[model samples]
Target: MPSLVRAASIVAGAALLLLAPVARAAPAAGGYAALGDSYSSGVGAGGYLADSGDCKRSANAYPSLWHLAHAATEFAFAACSGATTAQVRDRQLSVLNAGTTLVTISVGGNDIGFSDAIETCVLGTDEDCTDAVAKATTYTRDRLPADLDATYAQIHHRAPNARLVVLGYPRLFELGGCFPGLSEAKRRVLDRAADFLADTTAGRAGANRAEFADVRGHFAGHGVCASDEWIHGVTLPLDESYHPTRTGHAKGYLPALTGVAP
Candidate 1:
C-alpha cells in the first residue's frame, strides 16, 4: 500500500509540474503572501508546489490552490509546519512589502498547543477530556487572540493596503454518533475547542480590519472521525492523523480565496 501511494504521488507530482506553467514572471506589483502553520501548509494534500525542502508545504495548500486558481501575479508562501502566531509575524511577515496586495493566515493552533490538547483529551476518558478542554479553552480565550492581534498589526504596518484574511481552524470533531471511539464527553471537549478557535480567529480578524474565513461550518460532519472525513483522526490508514486530505485542501482553498480576494 505504501509503495502504491508513493507511486501515485510521483505520478501526480509529474502531472502538476508539467501542467503548471511558470506563471508569467510575476509583475513588480504586489500580489499575495500566505502565512501560518501546518494547516495552511496543507501537509497531507497533494499537487501544487515544486517539491521544495519544506516537506510540509504541499501544493494543495490553500495558498497554492488559490494561487493556481487565480494565477496571482506574485505569491510569497512562507507558511511552514508547526508555525505559531509569533512565527507568522517574525518570520513570514518580513517577506511582505508595500506592493503586497493580499494576505491570508491560519495560525494560533500551535500557540496554545491545540493539537496536543486534542491528542490527549479526545482519546482519553470523558472526565479527563473535559478537564483538558477547560484548560485549553482558558488558554485559547486569553492568549490566542492577543497573538493573532500582534500578527495582524505587523501585517498592517508593513503592508497597509493589503487585504488580510484569517482562516479559522476547521472543526476537528463531529457531532454525536460520528466516531464511535470518541466518547460523548471527549467529543464535546473537541467541539468546544474548535468553536473557541473559530470565534477567536473571527474576533481577531474584525479587530484588525481584516476579513475572516469561517472554515468550521464548511468542514462540519467531515472532521476527525467521520466516515467520509477530510481531516485525519487518530486511527489506522492515516499515518499523519490530524491533517487534511488532498480533497480537504481543495475544498478549503476555494472559500479562503473568496474571503480574501477583492
Candidate 2:
C-alpha cells in the first residue's frame, strides 16, 4: 500500500499538473470547499456527520480528512449523494466565493446512470451488463463532455481565484479473485466503464485549466475482490455499494490529493 501511494505521488507530479493542452499550478490551499456527488461527499467511507443530514457526509470522507490535515481560513463541505453536475452547479456552488482558494469535486457519474448500469451488471445477464456499460461509454463520449464543460465553467466563474481539482473514481474490481461475485466478463466491462469515466474527466479538467487527481493507480491492488479490498461489495446501506471504504479515502484519496495539493 505504501508503495502504491508513493508510486502514485511520483506519477502525479507530472500527471496532476496537466490539463491535456495546458498545465496549471496547484491552488493556494485556503478557504477550501468540496463539492460533487457521493464520492466527494464520502458515502462509502462511513462515520456520517449529522449536520449534513440526508447528504451523509462522512467524518472519514476525503474532504473532512483534508480539512483536518490543513489549516484553511474556512471550510465548506457541500457535496451530496446522487448529485449530478447540474445539481452541483445549482446547489453546491454557493460555498464558493472570491476568497475560496481551493476546491475539489467528483461528479458526472450519476448523470450517466452509474448506479443503474451497475445494477444491470450485478443482477442481470452478461449481455445486459455489456449493453449497460456500452450505453454508459457512449453517453460519456457523446454527452458528458458538454455537461462537464458547462459545470466546470460555472465553478470557475463562481470562484475565480480558487484552484480547482477534479477527482476521478477508481476501478471497483480486481481482475481475478476467489470471490464468487460478478463474472470475469462483467468485471472487465465495469472496469472499462470506470476507465472511460476517468479519461473523460481528465480531458475536461485539463480543458478548464484545472488539475485532475487520478486515484486509479493509488487504489490499484486494493479494489473489490482483492486480498485487501478498499471498495465495498453488496454492503448494508446499499448506497455505499461499489464505493471506496475509509481506507480508500485515507490511503488512496489522501495520497492522491497530497500528490497534487499545494
Candidate 3:
C-alpha cells in the first residue's frame, strides 16, 4: 500500500511539472501592446526615450503609464509620433501577436492632414483656415472611414485575442484665452473638426469590436487656453506645439485609457 501511494504522488508531481511551462507560456492574464500616433507616442509629453528617436516616444505616454501601473503584463510600446493609419498598419502591427491581451491606439489625426489644418487655423487668414478645415471635414466624412476600418481589421488580424482601445483627438482650444495669434473663431472651427474626427473614430471602433476612449470631456477646461493648460500652445521647434504636456499624459490620457485600457 505504501509503495502504491508513493507512485501516485510521483505521477501528480510529474503532471504539475509538465503543466508549468504551458502556464508560463500562456499567461492567465496580462500582455499589453500600444500602437498609434503622437498622442499615444507622447510627442508633446516630452522626456522622449532615446531609442525611439524621431518617433518621439516618451516615458510619460499613456501606454508607458499603463505598463508602469500594471507591471505584470508583457508590454510593447510601438506607437510613434506623427503616425498615420497606413504607418500603423505597416510599421506598428508587427508588435502584436496572439498572446497580446490588451492593445491601445490613437491615430487618424495625421491621416487627415491634422498639422496642416492646425497651421492654417493658427497662421493663415480666416478664409484660408476655413477652406483647410472644410477640406479636412470632408476627408473625415469620406476618406477616414475606409482607412480606419482597414487599420482596425489589420489590428484584429494581428492580435485576435487582444482587447483593442481606440483613443480620439481632444479639442485643443477653449472658448476663452486663445493662443497669441490664433483667433477664437478659428479655434471653434478646429473644435468642430475635432468632434468630427472623434465621431468617425468612435464609429470604426464600434464596428471593430474595440472600445473608443473618448477624450472630449476628459480634456475639458485643460485645453491650450486654460490657466493650467494640459496641452502645449504653439511652442517652438514645431514638434512641441499643440501636443499634450506631461501632466496631460498623466492626468488626461492616462485616466482615459486606464478606464477602458484592458
Candidate 4:
C-alpha cells in the first residue's frame, strides 16, 4: 500500500508538469488579427480559408494556413475584398489589442488600382501601358511610404506587443517575353510596377521594425505572363484575374509565414 501511494504521487506530479505548458500556451489575449485586402484573403487561391461573404477570403490563404499549421488559439481575419490602407486603419486596426501576438498585412495594390491599369493598358497598345505604368509608378513611389508609416503606426498602437509582418506584393509580370498574351513592352511595364510596390513595402516595413516578406523573389519567373505562372494571367481562366492560384498562394505567401506562430 505504501509503495502504491508513492507511485501514484509520482504519476500525478509528472502529469502536472506535462500539462502546465499546454495550459499556459493558450491564445494570447486578443489573438492574431490579419488585415489587408483580396490578396491576403486568398481570393483566387482556393484553400487558405473558408470562402467568406465579405472578403471572399479563402481557407488556404497564408495567414489562415499559418494559423492552422501552428494550431493558433485565436484568429481574427478582417481582410476585406478590396481594402486599401485607409480601410485598414478605419475598419480593422481597432480589433487589435495588447494581447495580440501576431499580425500580418498586405495592402497598397488597390490604392492606385494597379490591377485595373494592367487590364486596361496592358491589353491595349504597348505605348499606352508604358505611359500608365510610369504614372502609376510615380504615384506609388511618392505616396506609398507615408501611407505605410501611418498603417504601421495604427497597427502598433492597437497591438503593441504583436509581431507585425507586412507582406510585399508578388511580381505580377515576367521580366522578359514570358507572357505571350501581353506584349513584351506591356510586360516590362507591369514588371516595373511590381518591383516598385515590393521595394516600397519592404522599405516601409524595415523603417517600422516590422518583418517585411519579400514575396516577389519567390516567384521570379511565375508572374502573369510566365508559362508556369503563379499569379493569374491577364486573361484568367475564370473571371477573377488579379489573384493567385493555390500553388501561387502556397509559394508566394507561405514562405513568408514560416514559424510565425503565437
Most accurate candidate by TM-score: 2
lDDT of model 3, residue 22 = 7
Encode model 2's per-residue lDDT on 28-68: one tens digit a residue: 32499888887877878999987776677889998889889
TM-score, every prediction: 0.82, 0.87, 0.87, 0.82
Which residue pairs clash in candidate 1? 30-99, 48-59, 49-59
Write candidate 1's Cα lDDT for 12-100 as tens digits.
43222111111111123468887777777776675535644353567778778788877846887777766777766666677678999
State each model's CA lDDT, in order: 0.69, 0.80, 0.77, 0.70
Model 3 per-residue lDDT at 200: 91
Better of 2 and 4 by lDDT: 2
Tell me how far candidate 1 lies from the true structure as C-alpha RMSD in angstroms.
Answer: 7.8
Best lDDT among the predictions, by candidate number: 2
The residue ranges of model 1 lying beyond 4 angstroms of the native Cα positions read 1-29, 47-51, 178-180, 235-239, 259-262
Q: What lDDT does model 4 reach?
A: 0.70
Model 3 CA lDDT for position 219: 92
Whole-model lDDT for model 2 versus the true structure?
0.80
Task: Give per-residue CA lDDT, model 3, range 1-262, as digits (tens).
Answer: 2256544443333222101110001122338988888788887788888878777778988888999989877878888766778888878877778888888998888778766777655556778888998998888999999999999999899889989999988888888655354678888888899899999999989998999998888899999788888987755444667788899998888889877864
Model with the higher lDDT, candidate 1 or 2? 2
What's the C-alpha lDDT at position 101 in model 2?
A: 87
Give the lowest summed-lDDT range of ten residues in model 2: 16-25
